[model samples]
Target: MNLNQLKISVRLVGAFIVVAMVGAALGLFAIFNMRTLNDADTDLYERETVGLALVKEANVQRYAAVVGLRDAVLATSAESRAAAIKRIEAGRAKSLELMAQARQKADDAESQAAYAKVDEAWKADQNALDEVLKLLAASEPMQDSPVLQHLRDVVAPPSIKVGMMMTELTQSQERRAQQVSDANTALYENSRNVMLALIVVGVVVGVGLGVVISRSVTRPLAVAVDSAERISKGDLMQPLQAQGKDETAVLLRALESMRGQLVEVVGRIRQGSQSVSLASAEIAQGNQ
Candidate 1:
């Protein structure tokens, strides 16, 4: 290609690079955004799992307290009402705390369900505690079969149900957390693969363009060298029809025209020298 054409090709290459840079930049931004979203999902899953675990722990403690209270009521010793009350209040506080935390999460479906169940369980516990405390405050028979039966009907059943609910919530939380981890891993892998592919493509395209440009630069120089070699072999009888309107083309044309003119001038000078020698010989013959 000529210089102007090569310059145009270079400009086109520059534009291609610019477009590639933009695309790469946009891809990079998308990767960053995906990572950000993945982090958010992961953080939310952790908090939710922690909240469910908290609720499960609180439920177990409360269930244990219920069993202990049942045993206490079955005894003839003084009622441990203060300790029972403390346990119930602590359980309530823990449930509320965990539920609140779970609700405060940004966008987790499973966590919200777990929190709902915990809230219902809290309400049930509150109602059950109220009834149990009232029954005990009336000094119901400590060892009576009827009172033990009544405790069986209310506190025991609710505790068992709440504990089961917490167990289910915990399992659900575990599954959801695992899913989030898997999704994040997949996203990271996909991003890495995509970026690697783009880089490979970029390198291949860049090398190909480099070869084309190098050829463009070298082709004219090669033609000029060949022209010089031909001139050195005394083969400039015909003018060179140079391809491009460049300095090299002008130089070769000038040298080729000079060769033709020099050949004509030498012919003229030889004819004049022969004419002079003939004139001198005629003069000498006339003198003789």
Candidate 2:
């Protein structure tokens, strides 16, 4: 049905419902986009941020094991060597556990692969540390033993490789965090633009609807008012124009009916006055 054909109340109510629906849609849009951002934030914090910390902690534990191995080899007494050996084993175990934890936090395939490489490098370095500790436990001479000498030559490279792997893992986590942040930023910007567009469209539609309804209601009232003024001035010959099925149209038709009754009454008054004048002149001429 045509909007102008609708009653004033229905038009107003429909406009309100349309605006409300638009608002509800925009609200849901914002909520959905915000949920996406929240998920990204959670992943960045729980996986990338915390996982990077775990990898660094594991790296630190491995460094401590290296220090413990060095101390055990240089000790002169068996008791000192045994104590250092215990510390080295404890540190290595903690480092491996932390590495496992870090690997578990890996959220994506690339991060998991990076952690896998880190685990391999760590295992190789740990083996070297174990060999050095075993030699020290057996009372091998720290400076002259072949195993200790060989460890001295090869140990530094594996330790360095482990450090590199830790760096790689850290960089990977950082990159992942950056990607999440960048994606969220883009999403927020897009959502903002869409919301702005919706707001603009809503304003335009509301204004247009208001104008349409206002004109529909007022134009008919204006015509009724002008017709009423003409009838009050005794200009009853003009036809009334009542166009719609609204209340205003009913009022205009009622006014037209009243105008027709007034015309009949005035016509009767004019005919009665003419007859009285004719009767009075006929009586006066007969007296003369």
* Best model number under lDDT: 2
lDDT of 2 at 175: 69
Pairs that collide, model 1: none
Task: Give the TM-score of each candidate.
Answer: 0.49, 0.55
Candidate 1 per-residue lDDT, tens place, 56-128, comes to: 6655656655665565456443544555556566655665665565467525677568667867877887798
What is every candidate's alpha-carbon RMSD to the true fold?
Answer: 8.5, 8.4
Model 2 residue runs over 4 Å out of place are: 140-288
Query: What is the alpha-carbon lDDT of model 1 when measured against the actual structure?
Result: 0.66
**lDDT, candidate 2, 20-110, per-residue tens:** 5677677667867776876778677667787878878787777767766776876556776677678688778988898888888886889
In model 1, the Cα lDDT at residue 111 comes to 57
